[model samples]
Target: MPTGKLEWGRILGRLSPYTIQKGFRYLKHFGFKEFWIRLHERFEPEEIPYGPWYEEYRPDPEELEKQRKRKWKNPPKISIAVPAYQTPEKFLRQMMDSVLEQTYENWELCIVNASPKDASMEYILREYSRKDERIRWKKLEENKGIAENTNEALAMTTGDYVGLLDHDDLLAPNALYEVASALEREPDTEVIYTDEDKVRGEELEHFQPHLKPDFSPDLLRSNNYICHFFVVKKSILEKTGGFRRDYDGAQDYDFIFRCTEKAEKICHIPEILYHWRTHESSTADNPESKLYAFEAGKRAIEDNLKRSGLTGTVTQTKDYGFYRVKYPVIGTPLVSIIIPNKDAREDLEKCITSILGRSIYSNYEILIVENNSTSQEIFDYYRQLSENPKIRLLRWKKEFNYSAINNYAASKAKGEYLLFLNNDTEVITSDWIEEMLGFCQREDTGVVGAKLYYGNNTIQHAGTVIGIGGIAGHMFVDMPRERSGYMHKASIIQDLSAVTAACMMMKRQVFEAVQGFEETLSVAFNDVDLCLRVRELGYLVVYDPYVELYHYESKSRGAEDNKEKIRRFQTEIEFMRCRWEKLLKEGDPYYNKNLSLAKWNYSLRPKD
Candidate 1:
């Protein structure tokens, strides 16, 4: 084992100690399991522990099989609401047919036809209702928009919970079965949502991950990240006052934010229970969605932020562009930049040079923790740069502990903000400092990160996707530069559950508030743990693409072999399970639920 000399600087003051203490504890509880799961997978091998708790907790195979074959004693009654307005009969009929063909026998189809003049839609819906007693169809006297139509259907729902089916979307064959089972598993779960996939022209296009808890208002502020095929408790819907008609373009997002805020518990089933249809008219298919939906989303967030008593700037763009926020800073905020490195002097130099040269804002310092360096040339280069007053050196003379080194460096930082930068990354955008600074200046922003691209000009990380099943994977991995998929919606910098730590910024108050980083993580998931803690503070975590950086990832450091990889991965599992157990049990809002190791176990490892 390697031991690094600890450099403890002036301790953080006890000012607002009450808020800080409570905030820290809240994050610890909220994030422990998520951090544990990620780190456990990263550091501990699967050979060390074969079966997961689910296997142990699950019924015997024979018993499960017997139960599966058994008839429903008390089947759940679900009201599937489809608010079809001006949608073609083919699309409307497909949606109706999917619902009518549900394996679950107890369900009702409530289609509030808002179609301008389509009597054919009514005829098709009526034909289905006549065939199945459960199918119910109604036409509004006037053309109420999506929000109003959804509210109309919601008003007619008498089931325990309601499931919203889009006019064009399709449900998986077993979607209702899964939702019913999840509801049975946790009766207290008032809100239940599952993962979904994207379909275009009747062909499956791509899969989207399911998110956990899905309640954290800050996470909702970033985007309507959660796909809403929710089986929400009718009472919770009523309590939250159902859907607001004002948010026409993005009513589901507004209603979800309001409902989750009031709901007692949220349960996320990690399965692709729904298929989101994407055509030219669909928002997911249109790049300009950010223009219309995002603008409406910004208004929704501003409304929520005001209600939550948080004041921050909101930037919007008509085209695919960078969005920002500049919260007023009352005084100087200390920011600590932690870089964990090995022996790559050139990469380190480039990272530092870009920051020193491009960063417009000052009042920050860098802590470089050289980990088990075998290259004396790198050491000499450090000496050569020693004349730069802002850089400080800390050596981890033993085995590399990525988390431990950052924790050590953070103790030495005097700034009010903490930034974790990869040594192999270089700043590409000059306002990167202000881009991040503007976010942290707000009291509500807990973590801020930049978009990272590889040297080949491909994305390294746009955002982290929780529950890729092993060691939390990132979305849009290795995707080309022309693609503006999620980032398009994420363009307007706002609240997210977590942001990548590669080039992250957070308030110093938040850093100490979370008690720095957890050292047990050693190599992986330290940043994720930090981000989760930031969310616990009831603040927003943002990924600002405007603050761009080029990351030459894993070049200096060699890849961990199979055994080492498992060690890191196992630790990640344990950390996430322990810290964010609620999220794991519920699901992470930002992570795609469509992926499962149970489905594609062999492809779990990154493709070479």
Candidate 2:
């Protein structure tokens, strides 16, 4: 079997045929420039260089020493728990040493050894315990499973906050310090987690960093994205009853889910504070060794849904650890798909035909708002479309104002839900409306966005992250449709700050609550502004990958190549900055602070 670099080559070899077909299709729709971009992305190196990021991440030795020496006023004591079972002496020492080297002194390392007969492991534990009173060791008479062992370690904790660490993993030198800092900043923070990376081979080369967003419940349900360096208030952990025996392999996932459910505030530190060891025996290196873990994770998600009073079914995807959640539709509310079009008859026809022919949902109306189309063919097409009882034609005699056209059409919409769809977009998912409706109907959700692919099957918009291009930009743009994004986020249902209005669904109530779109800002950033306002109303903006579509993005409007268009775009950018200055400065809650704001893909941000 191929391994390492050869593995990707082998995989690519198998995908070449399908890739070629997809490439040709893209060329047919998007032309040569898009095809070339997709081709380049297909073979681009997946491993992102972390050298500059590490330089930015690493703290000064003198500053760290000062932090170690300084006294904190009434600092909360944190207990670090490690469950050991036949652990190697080398790995065991490294794990214990990481805790010992912490800059924050108000911490206790609790080790519960399940391997009773391992003399070397026991000796190392005894030596560490003898050196510092903070290091506590408990040797079990018999070998218990991971969950039971972890519970034993938890039982030893007397601190206000409790943290879980894998036996083979290594914590960063300043992990506890950062956790303490965040706690100092947010006293109400009940659940705290930090970003982590995987250390592979004997040299302990760190790579595959999982830079996570700030407390995303939907993202957590999709997978255990918040895996390592997890800390929680001891009271909350006690309420959750620690770990479950049934979910031994995924006990941490289950525990974290329960903790989050009851947490007042969940905080995420963007720095890498944990190093997950990726040896052959480690699950990080070979997930096939622990197939039961994924199954347990699915069960955990299902239980969470049940507890939250949500009607949903969770299923595992082809991607090893990722999951798919199908939220049950609450009611068969009429959905009015409001599409604004000027010309582009072929694009409009294709979009309408896809919806009428492929959609499984029965109750929906198509409202195509014609904005000054002079062509007779467009008029003839409109006449034919009017023949269909499900289609409605709304006329907007004014100049092309995307926001205004949508607002006018929305006023005429009679459905409970409003679907803002681009004329250039075609449906790829049969139950797209059903999927979107599921999220929109939820009490907490305001806007529901679908995963849009470029005509060639490359991602157009997975979700929108604020601060990209100094305002807002699409996430995972130009990525292949087949891949499971940074952390399988592109393949799962997750909460985002915003999703494009190009193909978005929202309740009619939410649209009115946020006063529809801002017409003053003519073209760009209108959808982003709308979503942000909806979020300000304390509702989640969801991005569902299952509701897939092909967005031949902006085919009707064309490019902003002219001076007037460029000036108008700049004006809109300024408006957004003025309106959402604080949010832009603080960054998107659905995106990590450590991630690059300049790039659409979740690249590491360089330090100033």
**How far does residue 564 in candidate 1 sit from its true spot (Å)?**
12
Q: Candidate 2 on 250-320: residue-level lDDT in tens?
A: 88889999999999899999889999998656778656668899999999999998998888889987656
Judging by TM-score against the true structure, name the best candidate: 2
Which has the greatest lDDT?
2
| Residue runs of model 2 more than 4 Å from their true location after superposition | 1-48
Can you list the residue pairs that collide in candidate 2?
A: none
- lDDT scores in order: 0.67, 0.87
The deviation in Å at residue 471 for candidate 2 is 0.7
**What C-alpha lDDT does candidate 2 achieve relative to the native structure?**
0.87
Give, for candidate 1, the lowest lDDT window spanning 10 residues.
1-10
